[model samples]
Target: MANGGILFLWCSSRLVRTPSFLLIMSLALADLLMMLKLPIFLIGIWCQGPCLGLFGCEMYGVVSVISGMAAIWSLTAIVVERAWVISFSKLGVISKLKWYTAIEVVLLIWISAIVVSVLPLAGWNRYVYEGYLVSCSIDMYSNNFIDKSYVWLLVFVGWVGPNILIFYCSYAIVRANRRNNTLMMELMAVGGDTAQNFQKQRILEERRLWRVSSMMLTVWMGSWTPYTVVVLFNATGYIHLINPHIGMLPAVFCKTSAAVNPFIYGFCLPKIKGEALKLLKRYRSTRPSPENSSRFPNSSPARTPRPSIIHMISINNRHASTSC
Candidate 1:
């Protein structure tokens, strides 16, 4: 929770204007919400025992699905934007992604999450307490056709579709990086000035992008795959794994993604690191050091200053006298 909170502050403070940064901020915000909600379930279990009442269980399910879906969609948007930037040289850079496009993506993510989340409330599927009766989900244990179809739809739209896009973007990025490296090498062979430096810089950026993308995809897969498998089995009536203890494991694993996303997405970026250092320096400068206090006892380090009313009145009197 602390890590995610700090990262959210850093991203919002430093990178608010950039397009890619906005998407990252969106992801961070979703993760922050997840961090907030999961503890309630834990505390409830510890205090009141595993099985929360119907209201609490339903609330947990709503929050989990919304935040989880938003995180996944935000990641999908990030990978797609990065891939577009790499493959299309004319876009200039990923950071400058148009405001309209960024807003559209964010809107789509939240709206889709809300619409899907409300479907159960609207009578399509149902949210019920599951997994030891402490955790809540989309009632995957039901074998009816409506429930099964809704589960399939949710899995495909919420998880499978995004994963496919992420994978495709990853592949395209690799191909684009290879092609760029080849061109850079050929230029170097022809004695192009600064070709080697350019090659090295591009290599570093490609490596960073690859690392970030792979880590995100890997975490997403690891966190959700078990739960997905369990849900599918339940939907198809192929498995009768009815033990609450066994059923809860996948849900617990999936919650780890909420904690893991901040580290992977925020701190991994060089830009974010630079911004963090700058902010730290600014914060330190604004504090009253011993040396500064000794040099000027009455002066305090402040970014902005406001004059007292008395001072303003004195200034106004002096202006009147000069005018007279």
Candidate 2:
């Protein structure tokens, strides 16, 4: 959580001005909230039971679901934004999108997440303590038709849908890259011009976006798919396929996504990285260094040195002589 917070703060600083920074911040906030669930589950264990009781367990389940949904949706939104921006950069109007537009898109993602999360509370599904007893979640073992239907619904809408969108956007980006490369080669053969050079720059940005988006999708699926598969097996009354203790593995894996986001988003992009370095230098320069403070306890800074008594007297004498 702290890592995500620091990353978000660094991105929000004026040093990084890209509109996509908002998407990164949204993802960080989701992961941070998800990480908080660790303590909530621990509290349940320390008490030898569901520490927050039934109501607390229900809220915990809702929060976990909401955070997961928000994070995935934010990721998908980021991919879409990057793909759209690059694919249509030739259009003057499309290139004019502002940072606030990204904020609105993030808001929409959270709204969709909230809607899906609250469906259980509206009686479409339910939450309960799992086999571990340390955490609460959607009761995957329930044999009730409503529970089964809800699980499938969540699998499709929450997981499958965003993944499909991600894959599709990635495909679009790849195709765009291929076409841009062909065009660049043809233009170079004929002698490259300013427009071709500009296109080449945009192509580079698109390639970076494709690489990052692909990695984000891979990491997300790698982390959460195990949990989803385990839940599906449990829902189908095949719990024996997975070890009882191993059921919690997916939750642990999912939380690790929070740890990975700071590294991927902050350290990957060159523009953001250059700005981050500048920010780090500014931070070091502004902070009070203990070594410097102890060495100069009473003196004015060297930048504007104070005049000594002898210098003051010499100046006074000089002034008197001039007056005389």
Candidate 3:
């Protein structure tokens, strides 16, 4: 909820949404949708039945597949965009996505997810209670040939394909960064203030690339990869060796990506951090301190207090000031 609130502020205050930022927003939105299903799941657990019985299970399964698929696809798109920029555009370049282009990619991603999600309902396979009957998913453990085929199709089209694309992009970006480092070294051999400045900028780029790569790899492995392994195990009858409850660990682990992602990318962004600080300051300003209220219980609500923060600026030959 805090992440959602900060996003609301970010959208309101942002003048231009670059393609990267737009992709990030899509990621957050998809993850948010996935997390929203948790309460429904909890309710179902509390009652000791599917949220709407079998039908509710179907609904939950569909929602989970769609949202989870969309989140991964969005991350894939983000990686692709980053690679595109690093490969072709100048360092630190910013470009806004064309509205139509953004719309098309987002539609393609979600539509593909929806198409796969609904197949079970259409009888290509079916949703069934799984994970000790607490949740529903595609009947991966079914012996039917049709169900087996669907699982294979889902693994290839939904999971393997995206993983390949993401890894390829990451590799390309790393190669591009290497080239950039060599160029930076040649340009900075002079050893002066200018060299120091260029060296700093290059280091920042390297750090940003490292963050993006590490976050992407960690999230993919820590969340989705385990679930993918679980699904493969179930499909192959390999899950029989493990305790049923233990096999469900991956499903729960994947769900956590929804929570971990926002902190990794959202809070890490400079703009989001700025907005968060603003929110904190705004909240503090509206609520009174316990010490002040106790010492002067009848004090004026609108009373002016000494500034806790001040800003100084140069306006040409004149100076300007502001305080908070």
Candidate 4:
């Protein structure tokens, strides 16, 4: 949880200038909350044996449901954002909005998710401790069809929904890139001009966007597909073949998506990577070196000046002159 939170903080700092950053940050926040909630749920299961008392269980249920739903909705928002970016490149329909609009959408997602989850507590659906293993989930095999309905609803909204949206975004981005490349070639064949150069640059930017979008879509699908498939099987009453421990693996895999976001953004985007390197250098400069300790007081080493790239270039020029 702490690591996920730190990554979220980094992503938030790096992406503060972009509107799409809100969606990414929201997903990170949701993952962080889920990570936090997991420990508490585990503790409850350990101490109280799956049947949590009124107070603790209620809080756990709320946190679990909220975080889970927030994660789904955040992914949905990302899919929508990517879709907009790819489908309508120059229009700026979705990207022009203020960050608060994204926040509002995220808030609504959580609110709706919590409302749906709380329905079971109110007798519309049912939640119970099936065994020492299962804590708080809709009882899949319950007599209430509401429980079954809720499972399918989550499967559709959380799993299939985002997958379809992301696939569409990926397809659109690829098609756009192909079209842009063809246009650029045609323009180049007509001879270079200021407008042609500008168009070429725009096409390059679109290609870059497509690459990043594809990477993110690949990660999301690879990480969450297993978990969703497992859930689908469980919901349909094929528990005999599925191990409970196997379900946890998918959750862990899905959590990795949050952790990987900062690294993905940093490595794939040169601007972000440069900023991260600068921050790292600044942090190292401020931190004290081990050689500066009192134990080495008698032996103060002389500080060597670090050579700049300009100095290296000058030295290379002098060496070439001497050789000549």
Candidate 5:
């Protein structure tokens, strides 16, 4: 929850307005909601059983499935958007990526997550207590065919497929935004403009959103990969190799991603960093310092001596490789 709150503070106004940033913000929101589940979980633990008994277990299971799916799929959306924008940035499609499109994308991801999570309640499979009966999830350990099939289907939909797309998109972004290719695209976009224009264009692409996005995805996958392995072991009839205690570790590991996501996002985006810097300067100037603060109590930052024709264009273009 703090992760999402801190990100909200850093990503103010225009920073979170873009399509890609909206997806990223959606991921943070999912994590925040997931963290809110922690209190119920702790209460259950304190009771030495499921809180509210079976009903509590059911609710927890449903919420877990929903938030987990939402977070992972939101990562997919962010990376996919980054790849699309950066790969085709020279085509001037950045202007075409609008707020409504982003809102629709986020809504679709949420709807899909809800659908996948509630399937267990609809008799496709069913949730059951797991890990000493304090928590619940889809019954991956069951012998029933539908129960077994649901786990496999989920792995395919949530992990295998999205990861393939993530990797391919990451590769595409790298290929399309390589130094030479970046120059070529900028040259074409500028239509034989001066070197000064070339330099201005370069500034807009300096902070690639895909770079931080890849880091977030990698960390998220690393945290969940162990739980995935456990699920696979159970589904493949290798359950003897796993135990309840071992199973608990991976589930705990998965929560670490929620805690770490804010740091990655807060420090990584250029616009956030710029805004943070401005805020920091303002803060320091307001403090009772001896030299700088006293000498210029109300001094505003001096504007750059040269005015930029490309300033707005650069900021608008910030939505592309930089991802708002």
Candidate 6:
């Protein structure tokens, strides 16, 4: 349900023709992929441990790796986009290409993820049941050099690299917003003209972007950091405690991140929420009042009282429209 809600909002927001909306859509797509792949992992767990051993774990491993990589890459792309916007005060070179580079980037990420994931099928790596816990992952400690290389690649590209990029981008945005705010306040204090007001508005927009980017960064780091740290520990042979039950904890946390992203991207945006509420109220107001419906004796259920909430909503909408 979280995935569906986010996907709906992303698609709806895309009609607004804003860079932020486009970035939200990109994040939404990544969340959707994560949500879609979750059931497979759950099913594997339900079957009493990574189910790949019973039913060709190789295929599951490939798909999981691909989806996971794509999700990470999407996060990286968002960070890059935010950096470009903050640094250049425009959509950057890719955005100016008029070729829907965001969509292309998403597609390329998926392709690369798939290619990297399926390397095992070509004997570059191997997939094993890993002691029957219905979950599948790369066997990093295996004797195969290819398997070890694949694990390192995933760690570098999907985990460490993205986190570094995201952190840098978030810091840059925060610093830029602070600088812009200071400049705007100084200009205002100096008896600035109307042009300064426009500049102030632009700085405000930048601040808003920084807030959203920071929210995403916080969520990403909080959700995935534990899992990455644990994996690193295991890979280095410092912590030999590899339990399937412990694995599920990280997966659950990661999946919950997807569930919350829609709220972050959609309901958090004041304009989008207001527009949605307006549409909902308009739809409700078209229904008949309870008394009027009863008097008709043959009214359908759809013609019942729209509820007192509708009136309250209508008033709110009127106030908002007037205020605007």
Candidate number with greatest TM-score: 3
Q: How does each model score on lDDT?
A: 0.78, 0.77, 0.77, 0.65, 0.73, 0.68
Backbone collision tally, model 1: 0
lDDT of 6: 0.68
Per-candidate TM equals 0.78, 0.76, 0.81, 0.69, 0.73, 0.72
lDDT for each residue of candidate 1 in 149-268, tens digit (9 for 90 to 100): 888887898779988998998898888887877776776775555876777787897787678667777898987777688877776676686577777777777678877876677666
Error of 4 at 275 (Å): 3.4
Q: What's the CA error at residue 108 for candidate 3, in Å?
A: 2.0
Pairs of residues at least 3 apart in sequence or in different chains that clash in candidate 5: none
Q: List model 5 lDDT by residue over 55-141, tens digit each.
A: 777777788888888888887777787778777775666534578988998899899889988898888888877765566777877
Instruction: Summarize candidate 2's per-residue lDDT along 4-96 as a digit string, tens digits.
Output: 544655556776655787787787788888988888877766887667778988898899888888887777777787678767873434554
Model 6 TM-score, all chains together: 0.72
lDDT of candidate 3 vs native? 0.77
Model 6 misplacement above 4 A: 9-14, 17-23, 40-56, 90-97, 129-132, 141-143, 190-214, 270-275, 282-297, 300-324
Which segments of model 5 are wrong by more than 4 Å? 10-15, 91-96, 179-214, 276-324
Instruction: Give the least accurate 10-residue stretch of model 3, judged by summed lDDT.
Output: 311-320
Provide the clash count, candidate 3: 0
83-146 in candidate 6: lDDT tens per residue?
7776667323343423377667766877888788878777776765543455555665464666
Roughly what TM-score does model 1 have, to 2 decimal places?
0.78
1-324 per-residue lDDT for model 3 (tens digits): 744853675576564255566667777888888888778767766977655678888998898889888888888888787788777764565544566877789888889989989999999989887665667778777778998898888777767988899889998998889787878789779998888888888888888888778777877878877666766787778967646577566567767888887777667778767777777898899999999999999896687765443322243224323331
Model 1 residue 153 CA deviation (Å) reads 1.0
* Clashes per candidate, residues 3 or more apart or on different chains: 0, 0, 0, 0, 0, 6
